[model samples]
Target: MELDLFRWRFVHWQFMLTRPSNYTAGNIGGSVSGVKIAFLGNGSYAFTVTGNSNPDGSIYNSEEAITSQTTGRLYGAIFVRHWDSYITPQRQTIFYGSLKKDGSQYALSKVVNVLKGTNLESPVPQFGSTDNFDVSSSGIAFVSKDPVLQPAIFTKINAYFVPLTDFTVASPPSPIQIQTSGFNGQATSPVFSPDGKQLAFLRRKSVQYESDKLQLFVLTDVAEPNSTINALPTADQKGAWDRSPSSVFWSPDGKTLYLTAEEHGRVALFTLEPPSVTANSSSLPKKVFYDGAISSAYPLSNGDVFISGSNLVDNSIYFHYDSTSGKSNVLSSNAKNGTVFGLSRSQISEIWYPGAAEGTQIHAWVVKPSNFSATQKYPLAYLIHGGPQGSWEDSWSTRWNPAVFAEQGYVVVAPNPTGSTGYGQGLTDAIQGEWGGLPYEDIVLGFQYIEENLDYVDTSRAVELGASYGGYMTNWIQGHDLGRKFKALVTHDGVFSMVSQLASEEQWFPDHDLEGPYWKNPSSWLKWDPSAHTANWSTPHLIIHNELDYRLTIAEGLAAFNVLQQRGIESEFLSFPNENHWVLKPENSLLWHTAVLDFINKHVGLPTYSEQSSYAKQLRSEAWQNRKGDLGRKV
Candidate 1:
């Protein structure tokens, strides 16, 4: 298990990766001719792991049972069930074989399924993996998702191409789709380059916006999948860069391409080079490092790179960089070398202000409170983030962490409103079809810029939390006028209607941000629905909802906790039923951060987990890390 297996990041491999049993829910990539494993497809059948080279005997199990759904009655679709099981036609195939070295024990011969009866399927649902497929000694580029549309109204995906066969041949090799030099929609992170004849991917043309803008295809020769496609800046090429990256790595010598994007609110690191193999630049992609949020980039073979990042009071760091003095050197950190998660970087800061359009500009993140003080005032928290096109960056987060609510004496903030995402894409497409109009006026101007310019924030002792579309803007500011200024509100797994979000299975995200299918556009989603402004309900909410989320499903948190319990307001619902749409176990994230910090510490007066403190009861501990460099990883 000490596999350097011949350094892959800098490319120098041979092959031997069969040590991670129990199948593989993702990532195992190897292909000078074998070893490719990736798991999970179950709803009925799923298994794919091969390594052919057979010296003889023992293990090789590839179970696939889909005798064509023999009637269990389930039809009319847009994804039978998505972000948490159900869709079962038993997809996810890829099997290949050979690795028979007998004596010291080894076996897995003949195998097969390389898209067996080709309609193609792969690690592409609920976000695919093993970077959606690669494998080299000549062929295997993968990237399914478009098994002929309908998976919630389209986002293409395609990319195919098979060609290395040897399962004693007979059926397998019609794959070939890779012709995306015309920038198709959704294709996704293919990789391949370090001499697999080239193949780097990331595409997007919006089959109805999934936060479009990825475009960065590279495919020369690829040994053949409709080969030669040198497209780099051609959409009327001349200055193509409005950025939207988030994936694309390779540069150890495939002539450059680093990517990663999400700029202003930070996620940086760029590099590219495809203006027909540039030697003088102009195909854009060149921002190489600009302070934190990196999330991986390896490269190195002299043109150094390493990287690993985090911020907002640090949870990890490790730099290196030095592409000949472009600067970055800080080789290790968990905030600081000797480990002092008592957090720092002066308790994080960065604001920006004003945005709801006209002269736009919004981005927030503030934190403070590792026992912070300048004549203490604290108690604000705020926090609303959940990909209404995501962005409350300067990283570090293990679910709603603003330094664990600034260690609970509060002062958190977090905004990035106007549909976040490293700012700039016209304020992230100004929340497409204007979600509740201008990200709810950039979150009521980030709570009127912390109730009119912070003074150690208090906002009448605020609270407000959020999940999924920040739980539909905590059920759209509880009912608006920003729920008469929150003293409480949480909402995980959000969205409570717009025609019960057609029980979500990703209908191209409410058919492009609630502008199309609610029975063919129900007034663009009952015009910014929070159950259509429930006669401005009195807020004291806290409805968590999970039951395998299915993207805003558990009946949108039981219709906003049965309309705040039949309008008598003061709500509270919290379900889990084995979680989904996040609440990822660890004793259910310490019973969801002790039921969202004890219902926002009993509505902001503070101290509730039995009158807190003991580092807020070591965030529900097993002495298993809660402070100091925070819960290991999951930023």
Candidate 2:
């Protein structure tokens, strides 16, 4: 083993691209779309379908989990994004084919078939570009771009309709012109109406505008060339970005449209009625229902809408008002376990996690401070979750707190933005490869949203911190911008150098390789590489990690500390030799939290030198050995 280790060091870079055979569930797209979940496999796969059959009379080959119901077709990304780049069979094309009863398969029966374009000879690119595809009642519609950088403007909404004979050659009739002149803003949250005749989408607000508003636009005859479209006004006359209109779906009746309004730091479900043109050719919108606490809502074809609430304990339980029975039961009440509110009395408002963004209905929890008072201004600690895929569920977290942060005179805003799961495939796929891009924007915008709309926050005194991926983001944010916004930062076991992470021959190296061969695309890796711009980092930071964490490894933390020292930055490093990916044990957690409080106090203008001195000394000795290049040296 020692000899092998030595050999690995000599040629560590060789194993940089040796990733797992294929992307794991981690690489799978986010939230489940329709009721018919799909999966991708290398021709060998198995699944079960209930009360469903393919056109070929075979039981559907289901692999991925879809969350919609009987009447509607679901959509999911075929490819997924990896660390610094995109992956393919991209989310749009990589779909699993379900089998029909008589042993026949649908168009997407096999993973290979999904990857093969009309021309089955050439394999698809494993990197670059992000797209979402949908097959509506009318036909198949795909949202793609000629150049990824050019706003993901909706190019063409396709319609493929043919009789049973032409099913084999089902091709699009023609391209629909949604935004012909090109939407001034980027195209996001595109959804087709029930009839597939019209398309509804969110036009993101520009960066210069300092607003995250989205406006709802309708493209009628979307599958036809030179179609008519209109950006409809809401009854409130408010812009969409603030409360960006999303999760847009036409009701089963098709008379009303359901949309989520996420703005003013609140997510509400709103129902809209399209305008009727008068002699002046103007239309009016009427509001139906608004539920602010329900920030993210999805309407199911079963006449049920699953809305994620801000309450910790019951954050997400399917909800519906039985118009017929006048009775409602929270769907899956059995799934709720007081996991979100372990502390009992804490009033959690929302929750956040690793992959979510602002304006995104991420899973999060907010607890009012103990002995709270409206007159008091509180501090904040923006807590982040790990996993770039892990969720900050209603479950108890050993990490940051709603009550604890609030008790510490801080308000916490945890948002699960673009990359978070439990939402659906489209939202999850959006964050792939866009790690630093969309995720960062979501975090910043979420923070800004809280400061603007929430009254209890003390923005100037807020701090940001996280572990693993969260730590990586902390380091990324600190290096990118620190205009005294975050009073302090704590990053635990974060990857500081993409170059080192790529070169290391560890268990993680293979999984990390899922990003694609760095040799093939250095630009993608650089885009999310925190170490690339460490030279610009100036924020006081606390580096924490477990000595035995193979996932991130101790060397990564040391590298970050060394870089900070080299730059004369105010920082400290902490480690738990007995811990792993997380500081799990109770004693370790207490110590960890104590150290964190001490660090925050010192950095947030309160001194805790006496309490932190001993730990500081211990870290200095350990850090100094590495600093002086003494440990790894063979004297």
lDDT of each: 0.69, 0.50
TM-score of 1: 0.33
Q: Roughly what TM-score does model 2 have, to 2 decimal places?
A: 0.48
How much is 234 displaced in model 2, in angstroms? 11
Q: Write the per-residue lDDT of candidate 1 for residues 1-635, one digit (tens) a residue.
A: 11121233113222234443322122223332223432111211112343211112112223322255465757676677788888754565556543433553333444456775666567676667666776655556778877777767777787776765343243557788888555557877787776667777777766667776676767766665565443455555321677778777777777777878878777889887743433323557778797768887778877678989887767788888887677887888876831377777677787888787889878787877877887878888887888788787787767766887787788888887887776666677668778788888788888888777888787888888888888888787888898788788888888866677777777777788776777776888888888888778787787888888787788888878778878777766667688899987776776678768887888888877635545435554532342446434321
Give the TM-scores of the predictions, in the order they appear: 0.33, 0.48
Residue 526 deviation, candidate 1, in Å? 1.7
The top-ranked prediction according to lDDT is 1
- Give the per-residue lDDT digits (tens) of candidate 2, residues 464-558: 88877788888888877642588888898887866555433232222232244476666667778888777778888889978756556678899
Error of 1 at 483 (Å): 5.4
**Residue 623 in model 2: lDDT:** 45
